[model samples]
Target: MQHKVIIAGGGTGGHIFPAIAIANALKKIAPEIEILFVGARGKMEMEKVPQAGYKIEGLDIAAFNRSNMLKNLTLPFKIIKSLNQASSIIKRFQPNAVVGVGGYASFPMLWKAQRKGIPTLIQEQNSFAGKANKQLGRRANRICVAYDGMEKFFPSDKLILTGNPVRSSITQSAVTRQEALMHFGLQDGKKTVFAFGGSLGAKSISEALRNILPQFVEKDVQLIWQTGKLYHDTAKAAAVPYASHVKVFDFINLMDFAYKASDVVISRAGAMTIAEECLVKKPVIFVPYPYAAEDHQTFNAQALVSKKAGLLIKDSEVGKELGTTLFSLLQNKALIDQLEQNIEKLGNSNADMVIAKEVVKLMG
Candidate 1:
């Protein structure tokens, strides 16, 4: 019999990209396997999954509103509705195994699957597991994790340290440094810095960089800055004075080139971003999003900082500390080389394949 599997979850690129990677890996290992994706309606996954060439069913699910209690009045009803939708999807798909990649949709889908006695797996991408994943982990057949010491959140025996799957383009890019610099219209023989804060953009990082734009000219440093959509206009306006050396964009479609061209990186500490940074082996300074669930971004950055693989600056301290820290690191070739060496050791180029194999094992 041909095996069918359902990979569920996705809200951000961190979840969506890894989910896609695993799907591709499963196809590579078992050409006969059939895969489907389930995601929350109106979320990024609904669009991104289809773009990745997978069939997806969307649940009318919404996460609990922590900031506004009034907004959560309909949350319980939404969950109940999503649970019914999840059950219907499961009944129709009849997947041999279900994989939860961590998002709002994962909870209802994996819950229904486990209750039906379907083999299920959880991919916990953060150093600190989300509440939904932690609850679902109890009955999951296997739990693939990116960080160490996750037993506190899930069953110890079920945990596999497969690392987070990053985009293959980043891990296996052939773009040369010279070509990359030319692609961004940056000058040669100058230290380059690439700064981004995820898809929506980070206000603090953008503001901090804006405050220090003049320093880039003095130090002969060039930059490729992805300010995200919200901050693009403001950042572009600010970079006018240094337009010759700074390239500003709302989103960067060619990250492999960006990685190749940069001598240093400044980014928010999302799991997917960290995974890519490690694979690219660039020296990075992470500013963890303070509002992340359980402050997990800080924990993610700490895992690297502990090994001297990366540096961490708190989101709140970005304004005061980012400039000094960034310029100091850019000037230190020895330290940058050390960071590159240490971080590369943490990259797992085969995480998707390893996770795919484990999912296949559960299928049997």
Candidate 2:
């Protein structure tokens, strides 16, 4: 019989892209394998998963509010409703295995799958475990993680250190620097820096870059900036005067090209971003989001920083430190080459295939 799998979770590109990569890997191994995705309603996964050519079911789920106690009043109801919906979907789909990537809908979907005695896996993409993943770790059949020290959170036997899965386009990109620059209408003969703060944008990074825009021009450094949705308008207006010196966008769909064009990258320390950066083998400066669960982004960057593969700047210190640090790195070809080589050693190009093979073994 053909194996049918259910992959769940996704609010951010970090989760959505990896989930799709796993699905793609599974399909490659067994072209007839059926795969489905379950994500929170109104989340990015609903749109992104479909765009990746997979069918998805969305549950009316929401994460627990840490700041507003009143907002969590309806959380229990939402969870219960989501669990019931998940149960119905599983019963109808008759999946042989269920995989939960971290997101609000993951708990409900994994809970339902485990209760039905189906094989279930959970992929935790962060260096520090989230509360939901920690709880699900007990019941999940396998816990696939990106970092090595996850035994502190999950049972040792349950943990498997499969590095995070990055999109194939990025991992296998052949886009040359000249091609990438031409695509962005950027001129050659100058070093280019690419800055992005995940899909939502980073205000601190954006503001810091805005203030240092003239400095970049003075140094003849070109920039490709992804301001994300929140800072798009502000960043666009700021870039208008220096169109020749910078290319700013709310989102860049062609990240493979962007990575190719960049001599250095400044980004949030999200797992997916780190994975892509490693594969691309670029010199990087990471500004971790402070509010991430247990400040995991810092830990993610620290893993690379410890190995001299990347540099880290705290979110609060970006305004004071980012510009000088970036310019200094831009002038250091030796340090940049060292970072590239060290980071390239850390890349795991076969994570998707590794996870897919594990899923097949568990199914049997």
Candidate 3:
């Protein structure tokens, strides 16, 4: 019989991209396998998954509103509705296994799958586990993780350290440094920095860079900045004074090129970002978003910092210390090389394949 699997979850690129990578790896290993994705309705995955050439079913789900208690009045109803939707999807698809990758949709789908006695797997991407994953993990057949010391969160016996899967484009980029610089209209022979704060953009990072644009021009440094849509207009307006030294975008379509062109990186400490940086072997200074659930982004950055593979500046300190820290790091070639070497050692180019194989094992 042909095996069918459902990969569920996705609110951000961190979850969506790794989910896609795992699907691709499964296809590569077992050409006969059939895969489907389930994500929250109106979320990025609903659009991104289809573009990735997979069939997806979206649940009428939304996360609990932590900031506004009034907004959560309908949350229970939404969860109940999503549970019904998840059940219907699983019943029709009859997947041999259901894999949850932490997101709003994941909880309902995995809960229903486990209730039906279907084998389930959970892929926990962050150093700190989300509440949903920690709860569903009890019955999950296998729990694939990207960080060490996750035993504190999930059942130790079920944990497997497969690392996080990054997009193949990053690991297999053919773009050269010269071509990358040219693509962004930046000249060679100057120190270049690539800064981004994930799909939605980061305000603190943008503001920090804006405050130091004059320093960039004075020191002969070039920049490739992804401001996200929210901050694009403001960032673009600010960069107008130093257009030659800075290239700003709401979103960057070709990140492989951006990685190739940069001497260093400044980014949010999302799990996927860290994974990709490891493969690209760039020396990164991370500014962990303070608002992340359980302050997990800081934990993610700390995993790398403790090993001397990366540096961290808290989100609060970005404006005060980011520029000075970045300039100092740029001048230290020896430290740069050390960070590059250590981070590369942490890269697992085959994480998707490993996770795929584990998923297959659960199927059997």
lDDT of 2 by residue, 60-125 (tens): 999877789999999888988999999999999999999998988888888888889999999899
Query: Which sections of candidate 2 miss by over 4 Å?
Result: none
Residues 1-364, candidate 3: write the lDDT tens digits.
Answer: 9999999999998999999999999999999999999999899999999999999999999988879999999999999999999999988999999999888889999999999999999999999998899999999999999999999999899999999999988888999899999999999889999999999999999999999999999999999999999999999999999998999999998999999999999999999999999999999999999999989999999999999999999999999999999999999999999999999999999999999999999888
Better of 1 and 3 by lDDT: 3
TM-score of each: 0.99, 0.97, 0.99
Off by over 4 Å in 1: none
Global lDDT of each candidate: 0.94, 0.93, 0.95
lDDT of 2: 0.93
Clashing pairs in 1: none
lDDT (10s digit) by residue, model 1, range 142-231: 999988899999989999999999878887789999999999999778899999999888999999999999999988899999999989
Stretches of candidate 3 exceeding 4 Å from the true structure: none
- Indicate whether candidate 1 or candidate 2 has the larger TM-score: 1
Residue 86 Cα positional deviation in candidate 1, in Å, after optimal superposition: 0.5
Ranking by lDDT: 3, 1, 2
